[model samples]
Target: MNYIIIKDSQQLTEVCQKARLADVVMLDTEFVRTRTYHPQLGLIQLYDGEQLVLIDPLEIDDMQAFSELLSDTSVTKVLHACGEDLEVFQHAFGCTPTPMIDTQLMAAFLGYGLSTGFAALVNDYLSVELDKSESRADWLARPLTDKQLDYAAADVFYLLPLYQQLLEQVEVKGWLEAVEQESQLLVEKRLKQVKPEQAYLSVKGAWILKPQQLAILKIIAQWRLLEAQKRDLALNFIVKEANMVEVCRNEMTSLKEMNEAGFDHREIRRHGNTLIEMVKQGQAIAESEWPAKITRLMDNPAYKQLFKLLKDEVKLASESSGLATEFLASKKQLNQFISWVWNKDRNPEQLPDVMQGWRKEIVGEALNKKMS
Candidate 1:
C-alpha cells in the first residue's frame, strides 16, 4: 500500500513520462461538488501497473504533463464506473482520457450485473475487501489523513488487476469492443453541453404544459441554468425546477404573485422580477414561434403494445446474444429507442442511449427489424 504523493512538478513529470510508456494505466479522481456546477478536484489516483501515486492537485502548479498523458491514446486507460471521474478530468485537463475502458461495463458483459460498485468488484474479483471508512470524506480538505490517502491509493491500486481479470473474461464473451464503445459514449454524454433552451424537456411536469406555456418554461429554465452557471451554484439553488413549471403554467407576473402561489420565497425574492420579465418576453413571442408540445410517449394509443413488443424483442435478443436482459437493454434505453423512432425529431447524431456504436450492431438491429 505504498504511494508517492506527487506535490511538485518534477515528480509529476517523472511519473507521467513513465506512464506514457505503459501499456495500461488505471485512473481515479476524488472531487467535491455539493454546491457548485463543477466538481472541485481534490486528488487524483494513478497506477501504471508499476508506479502507484496520488497526484496532489492542490499543491501542483502545472498539470500539463499529466493532462497530456491522459489523451496520449497509446496507453489504455482503465477506470471503474468512471462517469464522474471523466467529468473531473475533462474540467481539469480539458479532455477525457483516451482509449478508456469502464470496468463496470466489463462486469455487465461478464454477467456480474450492471453498475457494480468498485469495492464489490474488487472483493469478488480480487478477493480483497476495501475499507469504506473514508467513503464520504471531504476530499477537498487539506492534510488528508493516512487513512484517507490509503483509501485513495486503493482506488487505483487494485483497478489494474481487476481490469485485467475483467478484460480476459469480457474478451472471451467477445464483448471487449462493446464495452469500449459504451465507455466512450459514457464520456461523450458528460461532455455534451447542456443547452439552456432545451432544459425544459427534462422537467418532470413539462409534458403537461401547452406549447405557449412551454415557451415561458423554456425562457425561465434557460435563465435559471445560465444563472446557475454564472454563479457556479446548483440549478435548484437558483430556482427550484417545480417553481419554473408552476410560474410558467400559472402566468405569474411578479415575485408577489409567485409567493402567493406557494413558490420558494427566497427564489421569488431573488429572481422574481427577472423571472417576471422572462415570462413577459415569452408571451410576446408569436404563437407560431412557440416550441411544439412534447408528446408523452406513454399516452400514445398504441404505446402499451408497442413498448411490450420492443421489450419482447430485447428479451429474444438477450437469449440469442447471451447477454442479460438488464445489460442488453434497460427500460430507459428501450424508451429512448421508441422515442427516437416516434419523435420525428431524432437524428443519427443525436442517437438514443442504446442505439450508439456496438449497441446498434448487437441489439439495435433486431429492435429496428421488430419495429420496422
Candidate 2:
C-alpha cells in the first residue's frame, strides 16, 4: 500500500484535489477524546484507489481546500460509522462531507446486524482480518509505528471494496434511496450541536427527578459542560452524573460531605468551590421558577400498550430483515412513537415528517395498521 503522510496544508490540498477526481474516496479519522466531550483529531486518512494519504492536522493550518473537497457534490465520501468523524470535521473544518455513504448504516439496511464494528465488517465482507489490539493506541504520539500506520491504511484500503459490495447490495435490495436519504440526514444531524440547557433531557436520572431537581440538574449540567469545554476534559472526569444526582438529592454543600459519600475529592478539588456555588444557586431559586413538570409516558395505559406493540413490531421486523432491532429504532424513538400514536390531535398526514423514509416504510405500516 502506498501511504502519503500529509504534513502540511499544501500536501493536504494537493491530495484532496487528486482524491476529488476519483468517483469515491474512502475516509477514516484517528482521534482521541476520552478526556473531553469533543474528540481531538490526530490523523485523517484518505484513500482513492492508488494512494493512501494521512493528513497530520497538527502540522496543517489551512484545511480549507480539504474542507471544500469534502463538501464537493461530485465525489462520494465512503466511511464506516462516520457520525463522530463527521462531527469532528464540522467542529474543526466548519463543513460536513456531502453525498456521504456510511457503511455501518448501509450494512444494517442491507440486513447486516446493527452496530457492526469496523474489524468485523472488514473480516466479513473483504475476508481480510484487521488487528483490533491497537484500537486504543495514542494517535497523538510522535513517530508513528509501522503497526499503527498499517492499521490506519487497512481502514481505508479495504473500505473501497466494502463500499462497492454494500452499494451493490443496497441497489439490488431496492433500498438505495432509503439508505442514501438516511446517510444524508446523518450528516445534517451531526452538523448541529445540542444546546447545553437541553443536555439535562439526556441524563438517565432526569425522568425520576422532581421539577425542581430537574431544573437544578439542568443548570448544573450546563455549568459542568462549559467547564469541561474550557478545561478540555471529559464531563465524567469533572463530575459523574451519578455523583451529581446524589449531590442534588442529598443537597450536599461541603466537600467533606461529598467525600464522605465516596465521591473523589481530588477530581473535583479545583472545581469544588464552583460546584458548591452552583448547588447553592440552584437551592436559592424559587420553586415556581423551576422547569415545568415532565409528564411520565409510562403513566398512560394506552401509551404503554402502544410502546409494547412497537417493541414487538420492531423485533419482528428486525428478525425478518436480519438486522438488529436496536439499530432500526431506539427506546427513545419507541417512546416518542407511543406518544405520537396516543395524541389524537396529531395529524397522520404530518407523521411522515416526524417519522420519515426507511423507518416509515418498515414500522410505519404496522403503526398505521394498529391505529386503524
Could you say which candidate leads in TM-score?
A: 1
Which tens-of-lDDT digit does each residue in 340-370 have in candidate 2? Answer: 6666344567454226777777776776676
Question: Which residue runs does candidate 2 get wrong by more than 4 Å?
Answer: 299-304, 319-324, 342-354, 369-372
* Candidate 1 lDDT: 0.87
RMSD of each: 1.7, 2.6
Error of 2 at 246 (Å): 1.7
CA shift of 328, model 1, Å: 1.5
After best superposition, candidate 1 residue 195: deviation in angstroms? 2.0
